[model samples]
Target: MAKGQDLRMTQEAHVTQGPLTTEAGAPVADNQNSETAGVGGPVLVQDQHLLEKLAHFNRERIPERVVHARGAGAYGTFTVTADVTKYTRAAFLSEVGKQTETFLRFSTVAGNLGAADAVRDPRGFALKFYTEEGNYDLVGNNTPVFFIRDAIKFPDFIHTQKRDPYTGSTEADNVWDFWSLSPESTHQVTWLFGDRGIPASYRHMDGFGSHTYQWNNEAGEVFWVKYHFKTDQGIKCLTAEEAEVLAGKDPDSHQRDLREAIERGEFPSWTVGVQIMPAAEAANYRFNPFDLTKVWPHADYPVIEIGKLELNRNPENIFAEVEQSIFSPAHFVPGIGPSPDKMLQGRLFAYGDAHRYRVGINADHLPVNRPHATVAHTHGRDGHLYDGRHKGAKNYEPNSFGGPFQTGRPLWQGIPVTGVTGETVTPVHAEDNDFVQAGNLYRLMTEEEKERLVGNLAGAISQVSRDDIAERAINNFRQADADFGKRLEAAVQALRG
Candidate 1:
């Protein structure tokens, strides 16, 4: 008998209803198969439901990021553990026990969307904090420093890391050639080849606001700050061989690990710390504090513990929450602002521009990137695919109808500047030796770690075509550590033999 007739008859005996129906209240018929041309031919294009499904599927993917294309994300909360109101009047860090919802994305640089998780590359560590003031994005990286301080070399550096135009594959010569020419990359290259390069898992790594940023107070006091998110889970890494095996065994290992951990209630957490430098100290500092390629030594500026961030929730839908998410360093609240870091200043524009291209002009309207607090006024009119509810209110600012206006207070502190405006190479200080910290880091490693580091370096460097380029790259290692250079040279020679 038909199910509808059976249901009606059984209703006399108080039987329950069946499954839900379609939009027209008609019971769905044969959801497993689409209406096709006579059982075994082409599918009929006239089937509206089938056409709708296929059309949506075809447009499911958006443009991948130019860099940091592969990533994993989760939702979490940040709890203030210490009062930092003296430095900055940001509400989220002002009071102890105050909690704010946040979303974080950890990614690998120089990889496509389908790349391996264990590549020896810098990881993007970006956070979006939904505070009462607004959504403040701390777009950063796993390492505390970058390859170059200037923005002009960014495009060139990225090109070298990407696939070669002729071979359509990663060219080690291209990578080392760029590094050899640009000495500023020494510090970051040291970190990349070290044990921390191939982090065992995302939870076992730290995150850093690599560039110095500004923190302003209500009293107009400004402080330069560097953010550090120390992993409560502690640092862990895989050997080069182990990482290679895992890349083949599980390309999505990091993503799967995160999801499973959250499901099993093993939430990951990190302690938030900051190194603050006075606005007046930038001029007299031994090293240029604003340079993205350098670090302010702990002896000069120590870290102050401020809060804890705990990731307790996995996104229900990865595409909607993680893939569509966007973060920009320019997204700042009243108390926070950008520093004079050249590379950082470029990223402040580049990140937003990339997001607009990959996602949409209305990308901010997406649920993941949207501000939790109500947006009072924005002059941004319409663009491709806008989802915001724009009522009859006047769209333009400075209107008679009380549109959002500036508060008239200085958003950041004005530091003293006394240099003449001219086009010339700025003189680097005598103490700005990029090789020192790198050498120190190399010397600190254990014998086994050193061997693995040498092997890893040689494995990539041996693939380079030019012998002089290889020698120059080895010389960089020699500058860092003599034994490091000797071991890497032996490894490469053996490979050639």
Candidate 2:
């Protein structure tokens, strides 16, 4: 034996198990084959193990997400580079150089689970930070704005973007009709058809909170902030033709690329930044800061670099860590809370509710959604597939038998609101012109990018059977820019001819 090698041996050291066993510890027989009717016949249902495996497989799939069904995820770390404790009391951001374990999921909205990864759709950029206080989930998207600001129209808008019931395929008419009728969608629609629409890959795109959120400090001073995860790899995009070919050639392009990149040690990273606006400024801002369809121009509120996010680990199990992962905008730690963003307010309920329906009441018990910090108190108990961690602890609160007691300090300071309670429309800002930003974005595009944008829009719009729908969509584009509408119209007409 080598000098460093252990040469000692014991009689029982090499003992091994006879065979595999069931979950109940019963030794499994005929391990090499399933109990079937014959060597080449149908599988026998009487084989409990086989039945269990098949049954589990059949029900393994949960309800696909209503939006952002196609996604790829990885584990990463977020390190704070700046001190913003005066702005937020969140423990993760309290000190410079603090790091938090994070999981990020990038997705394509309006695509099914098996759909093409390179589809022309807005991508979901959701991040969950495992902090000592609790998990903070920043559920956002690639675009800085959304199609609709109001939650009531969200379902309707999603229905339009999805496959048409009659045709079982995406119809441009369905999408355009809804967009033309809902003027609020104009801003996001312009972005959807622009150069940034078809991102080259998940790593090459930026992520935005899209809605304003409130951050409160220990002194109870609150500030409205927006998160921006600017890709360190720089923004890159695929042209319409390139995207289409890639989609056809490899529907799992983005997913495979992320996994292979990590395996090759080429970890992707992003610079975490924030645009903070004083609560007082929001009251006088030119645009409604809470509107989901508008972005606070970087010039008005410059981005302050906060930290960096580097994704270095691929999930060990896709189903457990990636598929079953749940994130809600409602999941906020101290110092962070929702703003008056209407869509966000609705999501605070909708996301949690969706998780309950899809992943059960104990969705939080799942390893992916579970917080790294210990949970001392919870009123919720005895749901489907409960793991029974509560054990002998009292289930009810406010009891004298050593039940959990409430803390005196509030989670965060609430913003003061003195308004009438009535069914009235939200007040629009005085300088709210939906076309200005869209026009500016269009003008900012390079000539080649603009050509691709025009071609992409014309190609899709030309597929609409209804001439009026196409015309209405073109008219909205015309409102943004005359040249844009003219070019799109010409391309669309040429295709029709």
Candidate 3:
């Protein structure tokens, strides 16, 4: 029994191999029928086994996630390929050729547990690395930018994406109305309506740690970094028509594709890279580096190739590995820490809290989420599923008997801050206008891509019942680029008519 060994690789002797038994391990005399009083009289209340079976069956289900409920996961390895000690002293990236066990879960943002996977929505790229220091989770999305920059607007943004309380369905009016009011959503709106909106499969799309994060070296030099996981399978996407047909035919299209691909021994992989910005340069950058609505152009900070990630195995039990898994951006190791990204800051608390409520407080003690290389020593004890591994050890620190003590070293470096802390807007950067990057993205597209994007936007916007809502949404695009707006308006009008 090695620490954190994959359950699939272990010997099956521990599994049930004998006659059918109750949960208490007692052999059952009869399992086919309930122990009724002598040939179908009133069923006996003394049938403990029957009661146990019925009770367990009734308690089988757990609450599904509010978002990202439709998901698939696989076990993988992340091997560092380049030296990056100058940027971060994280032990997982301490040297070239360092390999770490990883589990990656890909999911749709707004889908329910039974929702079709081929919908046009952002995919969650949640990766958990079981490193020697501790588990490090990089929870991100397929898109590099998001709809909103601040955390307070997150609930409102999601409310639009979800089913309307009154309509009992995801109304186009609610969605367009929210986006129309929030001009900051323009950049991500452009992405969502583009060709990449509906990914052909999980393996065919790239992943991004969309928010800026902090990395520090042993010498205390800090650098702001963004992560990119480029799919080695190459980018593949589905058109709106193609996605609709696929979803209708196979609701689990993306899940089946990923599973069958790995079953054929064709493992999917990604070329991992990061764009590093020195700490000193972040203050006066052209755009606010911490803005979740914006992306730092490759021209400003070139991506540095660092590692390779390969998914080699699929989970034997989907319930144990995929459904029960948890990830949080706050799960960082030494040298890696949070930046001032407002969205990221809010997620640091929200994600962990969600898991605590959804999965038990001892969710981390589960083999899927636990550390592989080292045991976690903590004072917290006695919760649902707690293994009681710390038997008889003094729970309190600084006891007469030897007890675990702190090392007096912080895992991450701190930053200098000033000014009063209150409800204040983000500090303005010189080139922080919301529409500039959206316009740039529109301009970068080919003529055909531009046409498809316009068609997608128009089709959805035209569905809105209110003319004011549709116009406001179109005006945001118009602000991005005049030509783009004109074409979109004409297309929307034709569809409306």
What total of clashing residue pairs does each candidate reach?
0, 0, 0
- Candidate 3 Cα lDDT to native: 0.87
Task: Name the lDDT of candidate 2.
Answer: 0.81
User: Least accurate stretch of 10 residues (summed lDDT) in model 2?
Assistant: 36-45
List the candidate 2 regions with Cα displacement exceeding 4 Å: 1-62
* C-alpha positional error of residue 20 in candidate 1 after TM-score superposition, expressed in Å: 65
> Could you tell which candidate, 1 or 2, scores higher by lDDT?
2
Which stretches in model 1 have alpha-carbon errors above 4 Å?
1-62, 422-427
lDDT of 2 by residue, 221-294 (tens): 98999999999999998877799999999999999989999999999999999999988888779998887888
RMSD of 1: 18.6
Index of the highest-TM-score prediction? 3
Name the regions of candidate 3 deviating beyond 4 angstroms.
1-62
Q: Pairing residues by index, what is the TM-score of model 2?
A: 0.86
What are the candidates' C-alpha RMSDs? 18.6, 18.7, 17.6
lDDT by residue (tens digit), candidate 3, 213-245: 999999999999999999999999999999999
Of the two candidates 1 and 2, the one with more favorable TM-score, higher being better, is 2
Query: Between prediction 1 and prediction 3, which has the larger lDDT?
Result: 3
